[model samples]
Target: MRISTFLLVLILLTSCSEKDKHPYTFYYWKTKLALDQEEKKALDKATAPYLYTRFFDINKVNGRFQPVAVITENKSFDTDKQIVPTVFITNQTFLNISKEEIQFLAENIHHLIEKKIKEYHLNAGQEIQIDCDWTAGTRDDYFSFLKQLKKISHKGVSCTLRLHQVKDKALMGIPPVEKVYLMCYSTSSPLENSDKNSILDVNILKSYLSKLEDYPIKKIEVALPIYSWGIVTNHLGKHKLINALSQNDLKNPNFKKVSDHEIEILKDGFYFGNYLNKGFMIKVEEITNDQLRDVITFLDKKIPEFTIIYYQLDAKFVINQNFKLISKFQGDF
Candidate 1:
């Protein structure tokens, strides 16, 4: 009888844990400017009662998340950051990374993190997500890299993938890993007529999402651009990035203008041979705020596994909202 009681209690505990392990959506902060400790705290407070993922603006590495200190160290910036109990996705620009480089890159990442965890004695809470945006053409190499990456990832580390990569892939082969976060940005690119002025068309988005029906939808989190979307290019000539969408053209006077092909560029962003693609730009619409909630609802119906997380709360858009509208849709915040 005592044994039976203990077994029942254990079962109850297990059940409780599973229930608590909810798929969460995070309002992630992405910027090249590192937040000071005080700023981090303020940001944390702003995003409280919801899981917040913070990206340290370190754009130096390939196939790996740049450690928080990479950017902070340069300025002697110190953040006594008790990173909130949430996912922290380090951006690893891996498109240029080659297959042979994968294993070596993963090792460097593993050691850096292992050393940090030991140094800080930090509990990064549940998971660490890696943000990589390699294109479909390089998907196989990416999979190979992750396979090797899993071998090196320290305990409690998982990857955050863009929606396209997760399609036609297996996430579990990476060892000692759990969960995958899905990013749903990059629905369309711009035509060459304008420097940067692409539209996030509803039709384009729906079509892209339709292809990902097989991905593990539950562990998904969409990363939305919170700031006004801007495109920077160099007219494919100068090395420096110029504005793709002109700030002068926005609905606000402060907003710039795009090329004369404004309407066509917004509707379709591709270029023909005569025009040639130079730059494409756009500012994501305010409508997407409500659209996010709607998208989540729609996705939830098709696949019960979606963990809907807002990409960021500290982004300019979130801060600029009218309070009355926010209160009405409490879920957006």
Candidate 2:
């Protein structure tokens, strides 16, 4: 009886220790590597030890695969904070791409990463992450490109996994990487005229994460959304994503409250560089603190060991977030 009781206590202690060890990091996903005073304060408040910075994106332009929106590092990061160079490749880049082209692309990507690291004096060279929403048709080529990149870069490689890829791994196949960052947001397209929040819907998240534990990749990190956007729609059913506009921006006299999550443009001319007509509707989609806590609780039950990476590092969002609530389930950041 005593032995059984001791074993039970040991199990409880082990579980608690594991729960306390949930390390978290941030993803800096901006085209320009510069942080304002507020952003710097947010970083310090979060106590993030490392940042996954986007180096550039690869897209197909005029039938040629090329890097676009390459990051310009205007400011250097703290020496103590590590930076993980990240590259986002569009899935269309792999459509009908040849093996030779894949190899060439991998080589050029590696070279550019090295060049940027050197040029910007960035304290990064350890790990590289690739973000791509690859389909079954392009899976093989994408995996091949990752393999080539891994071989050439000689650094740990990681990739982003969407919800569909997690649930349908058998069909989509997994990428050749050491770790996969499961993106827990962006469940749907913003262009859709649905009432649901495309940034994050708990119902949609639950549907896709049913078999999360059974995912083949053991080392899985989760990225949660901390950003919000305004979906502007006109009478003709046309939609545009005004990323800079948030719920707070709706308080202006130019907008009239339509609903708790929606507003109508009143006598609008130009707002946030977008010309809007009167009567245009805007849907504000954002994740709340309570919703974030619920997601953390749910994920803690599913993933025994994983890191939480906030989708991005933005001052407006990060400064307003309650990190105490965010770190409640997973311990302090």
Candidate 3:
């Protein structure tokens, strides 16, 4: 009787301890910061401790790289949640920046970010995340900018990691940051003719993660995709991306269901600001709950403990997810 009682106590303690750990974080990548009803419900359900907000983007304006901050209502949100500002930079923008302009770029960028944080009153969170899909040509400039940015924000710094960067570490040298958030989605190109999912392919994910064990980075987290998109291919076989379009949007009589994903456009006109040809095909790509579960299980074996940030908190995706299961995958259960 005593042995059984002791075992039960141990189990209870373990469960309580797990619950006490920080809840998983989330990323709000939308240009507008307002949260819809569904998004608010999802955020409440997840009970996330950190919210990584995309403050602005760095794009090339004329011949100069400038910071374009996204407009956020900044009116309603949970004040208890910590905010981690994220800055996105176009890879081409770094290529345009001259060697002598690196310091100027870094200083101006940091000032712009600081202004946004002050305006939003997001002073509680100390960590700042940099989101850039850097390439071999821009790696030197990107890394140098990171080193400079670190001097401005003395707090924790984190950058995103793509699968290709993980595979080719020689060409994609590590960024000088405190933390690296491995983006585990977008493993394949949606423009390709393949039937496999572009968002999350288990086999492709395994291939990249197999090399993760050898990755030199120590502090690492993961960002998963919870959203979906449609790839519109014209008669010329050129692909154009359409965001947040659903099956209901394709229910028009002009569209014929070719396959589960592919849709044949019988009539061509202006649709979503694009000139749709008659032979246009729209392929819908998404990650289902079961697929997400499988990914969590796979990662459970490889990385038992780490932070998880959903791609973005969209209403459609958040309204349909099982928050309990997602919390479990984040090691909160």
Candidate 4:
């Protein structure tokens, strides 16, 4: 009788551990919402339980905050998986807003999000996530807006927590949200020389984790980057932004591969997203499988309860990855 009772208690403990395991969430951040065959196949293979889809971006235009919608024509998002409509707000939008104005802005944005969710026939109330890199100046207004948003939202609210913000929480103040999604990538500066690995530098990220022990928020969801981009620079060595093009695309005669990181433009013309004279440079930045593993291991040791969220669900990033390794960091694995 004593042996049987002990086995039963062990089984119950194991079951509870399994129940508390965090679910993996993918972020679908494309301006268009339609999933291609490749993306759909990747999603099916991923088996992620949730998707954080970017609904729109809030930008300050003509001194007024406006929601620039990312309208979707196709509504083929998987119904089996939970959907969280994510809103990306520019920090500048909250810089000059009053408390009352912030409240009104929150109300309008929430309504627009609901309208989009209804149009897409997507499930609501799992919880909505907000992505914003708020600065010291805009922290109060932004936090106030979050407070107002939570009051109106039936579901809970989540905010993107940057590394700098995490380190300087005392100065920036805690955002009024239920869950905070800590973005672990983009730790290095883009304007720095090509030597700096901005995507996932373990050295830079470790310093920021020490402060998490004192952070009041218990619930944290971590978003790690699986995507890569190219920083384009002109002849004058000024930095420009461009989506990463395939190696084959850069193989054209107009682009001379000076080095693995440096691409010297052979022709003076418009390219990628910026107009360039000859001798322009494009530096490719990416997170490797090893780097991903390192970050995951470091985070697991420091904050084991944090949920794992891949930056995106697109095939371009997911296809080449060893997700089994990435998911292993989660307790569910």
Candidate 5:
């Protein structure tokens, strides 16, 4: 009875100060999964101890023409933040979203945002952030797209730009981007005995980042991969193609389920011959201590103000890190 009474009092105190005032945290969902009640509880329990220490949530909105919010994640929303939440639309194919499309999506998104806020009985936060990875070649078009997004979105709408691999001297002047996310990972696999010149390209990226010294560091974020991926190719499909695949050269997924004919085709050297002796093997890459240190060391010196965003909540490839000391990230061995 005493415990229950104390809990009620605690809840009342917490209810009085739910809205938080601080920089928001933006997290991208690598894959769409329907969140469940148990899972939601698990998450709340996991982050409960942190409380206002990390007070923000980034609900990623992904898809093409469908304009779908397919990720229906369940959360306690009992966060220290009073803001409803923020959204980051992740896509870059369209040269322009067009005023018409922005106008259309805004209508639907507003209601969704409102419903979540009401369901949680909390004040929804201001602004929507779109995530686009475009290049200088399409500078004009990208700006045009941002204009459309800003115009149609609620009053304080903004966007995030994915800076995976950029030239040191790509842009002359700072354009309009709420935050520029430097993505330091490859869609492919990591190479062995590499100095990580390909991913973060430390020396090159640092030189280019120097030019952006005038830009707002608060708006800069770095995409550090907590995940790893090896290469997986369909030998059967590649057989009819021009370029053959080298198995040993790339990390291959387990293929016990692969067809025998595919293996035979691979053996013939038409596809996946880069690896020796039916050597089609996959090399799984993770956030090794050396790789993490390499990235942290570079970013600490190059772009210190940028927030380090964990790519997703969890990916088969991502490392679930909680301790800050794990600057040298550790994952499945």
Candidate 6:
């Protein structure tokens, strides 16, 4: 009897462990649908069930809503992994859009996604994700649009939830979707001149997620930041984001270290195709492996079940870390 009981308990524990394991995924935010050798290797290592590919972005252009940066090349497609076509619509698109316009926009978006899937011969999944940072003013219209989209597309719809949206759901209102992908990065504005890393800050994340456990949305997925950028501040207090810049790139004779994260350009004509003047400040913000682990630990406590989708699959960033380490965070915590 004692041996039987022990075996039963062990079986239950194994079942629970399998249930709690989180699935991993990746987001392809590039305009083209082509993958290099490094990116292909990362995707294979991740073994994600699905890949969220950005189809295009929508914005109001001269009183007309149109799609921009549509995927023009399709050099790669994985038959094993399903593709979730993601559309990014600007919040301003719904600012003053009428009900009739919202309906029309939904139909147009559905048609475009369908056309793309057919044209590219993609192994598209039955779900589509909408990425928008809607405010209170546009909340009602955006929700209505989502409903219209669901009706027209006849597929599972998901949207990206910002940190502020989770904290202020009462004011902003919950989106009309079955699931929401909570974006855990971009805690602060990049244009702001500050010493803190704008990409991912644990304290800032905690402040925004004070009420995460109580958040009504139960089926919540997570997307973490795996990318970084440089905030270039000019002499006149102007700020701009310089992409493809890293801390190692700043370690040069032309630059002087101001702090651990800040650097001053000593003599620069043009670096990385961006002209920099002497005394200009560059703040490098990148997420470390330790920070990623901390974020996973903090989130695991509040949310029981979730799929971790890295913000993007970039060769430049993915090659810097061990594929096994980056893909297996779920089992570690």
| Reference-based lDDT, each prediction | 0.44, 0.84, 0.78, 0.77, 0.43, 0.86
Candidate 6 C-alpha lDDT tens digits along 1-333:
999999999999987665446667689999988888888877876645798999999999888998999986656655467999999999999988999999999999999999999988888989999999999999999999999999999998999999999989899999989899999999999988776788988889988997799888799998988898889999999999887677888888888999887899999689778889999998888888888877877887788677888878988788756634543465344
Write one digit per residue (lDDT tens) for candidate 3, span 273-304: 77888888998887776776676767666655
* Candidate 4 off by > 4 Å: 1-22, 246-259, 266-277, 329-333
Q: Rank the candidate models, highest TM-score first.
A: 6, 2, 3, 4, 1, 5
The residue-by-residue lDDT of candidate 4 on 265-314, one tens digit each, is 88888776577777777777777777776777677666676567888877
Looking at candidate 1, the ten consecutive residues that score lowest on lDDT are: 324-333
Residue 283 CA error for candidate 3 (Å)? 1.1
lDDT (tens digit, per residue) of candidate 2 on 263-307: 888996997788999999999888887777777777777776777
TM-score of each: 0.55, 0.91, 0.89, 0.86, 0.55, 0.93
Residues 59-140 of candidate 5: C-alpha lDDT, one tens digit per residue: 2235344433433433523444333134544335344556565555556555555565455555444555455554655455
Q: Determine which window of 10 residues in candidate 3 has minimal summed lDDT.
A: 324-333
Q: Residue-wise lDDT of candidate 1 within 178-296, one digit each (tens)?
A: 56655555544533333332344444555556755565434444454433333333335322222323333444322244543231133223322122232433332223455555455
All candidates: CA RMSD (Å): 10.0, 3.3, 3.0, 3.8, 11.6, 2.3
Q: List runs of model 3 lying over 4 Å from the truth.
A: 15-22, 77-79, 96-100, 269-275, 329-333
Residue 259 lDDT, candidate 2, scale 0-100? 92
Which candidate achieves the best lDDT against the true structure? 6
What is the Cα-based lDDT of residue 77 in candidate 6? 51
Q: How accurate is candidate 5 locally (lDDT)?
A: 0.43
Q: Which ten contiguous residues of candidate 5 have the minimum total lDDT?
A: 47-56
